[model samples]
Target: MNTKIYCLEQCFLPKNWELLLSAVKNVAGFCKESGKYDIPTLPVKLGHSLSKCAKVLRTKAIMEDNEDVKKSVEGFLKLYEDEWNERISVKARQTLYDAKFN
Candidate 1:
């Protein structure tokens, strides 16, 4: 999925940086959620995908010499890291456990 989108963005959407950036940002946001029915690993899976997508987009941004898009991709990459790297609060951990097991 990341490779396909990257190819299309690179070959077809070269002048449409906003759309390309938006796609990554949308996925990045979605991957941050831990909704009622979401499994504990949901965010991790989506975050991994987001990381892959963002890395490719970052490379494309660099190739295009577009600092704004590059910066945005970097931000998304940071978000991807935070999705899994942040330590869970005790309260939040309880909530997640209940959601999955109860």
Candidate 2:
């Protein structure tokens, strides 16, 4: 079953957005060239991963069943709903800025 990882419509802050946009651009190119891989929606999966990355950052993770692991991730994602939108907004602005420049 596919799970909605996180809704990032109204979260995200004003900092670190540029990094997110940059990563999205880089990852888009990488994923396109790399064999089989998911084509992530900009500011969507990118935001989800950002939120999850923050929680898992510098933390040790244990292996688990694949399905169970995906569920566990969704549970973790729900907890981050609070911060996702803010992060997305900020990243979007950065994307805007980069567009203005380049």
Candidate 3:
């Protein structure tokens, strides 16, 4: 009965579906690389890329009617949300900036 659960029941065109899938893959790849790298400023760069990809998935989800595509978008949203929640603080950002400029 939940609206969020029901939203995934819709369908989408094949081309749009493909695009959504590609965005999901790209986001996943960025996430993997972000976790793999230990460089101080790497998360910021990867997060930026992930955010862009998440935005694409979000936009596609709004216009897509396919249940599969909706599910994929939902998964990516959850994953990225968790990643963002653990984002580096301003202190970390300052450290990265100082490291680059100093």
**Distance from true position, residue 47, model 1, in Å?**
0.5
- Lowest lDDT 10-residue stretch of candidate 3: 2-11
TM-score (C-alpha, index-matched) for candidate 3: 0.41
* Candidate achieving the largest TM-score: 1
lDDT values for all models? 0.51, 0.45, 0.47
Clashing pairs in 1: none
Q: Which stretches of candidate 2 lie over 4 Å from their true place?
A: 1-41, 45-71, 97-102
Count of backbone clashes for each model? Answer: 0, 10, 4
Report how far off residue 3 is in candidate 1 (Å).
28
Per-residue C-alpha lDDT of model 2 across residues 2-52, encoded as one tens digit per residue: 222244421232233444444555654433343212333455666666666
RMSD of each: 8.4, 13.2, 10.7
Off by over 4 Å in 3: 1-38, 85-102
**Per the 3 Å backbone cut-off, how many clashing residue pairs does candidate 3 have?**
4
For candidate 3, lDDT tens digit of each residue in 57-93?
Answer: 6677668755566666566656555644353323336
> Of models 1 and 3, which has the larger TM-score?
1
Q: Across residues 1-102, which tens digit of lDDT does each residue of candidate 1 receive?
A: 333454533422334343444453354343335422223444445445656877898899899999987877776566545543443222234456886686
The positional error of residue 70 in candidate 3, measured at the CA in angstroms, is: 2.2
lDDT of 3 at 54: 57
* Candidate 2 TM-score to native: 0.27
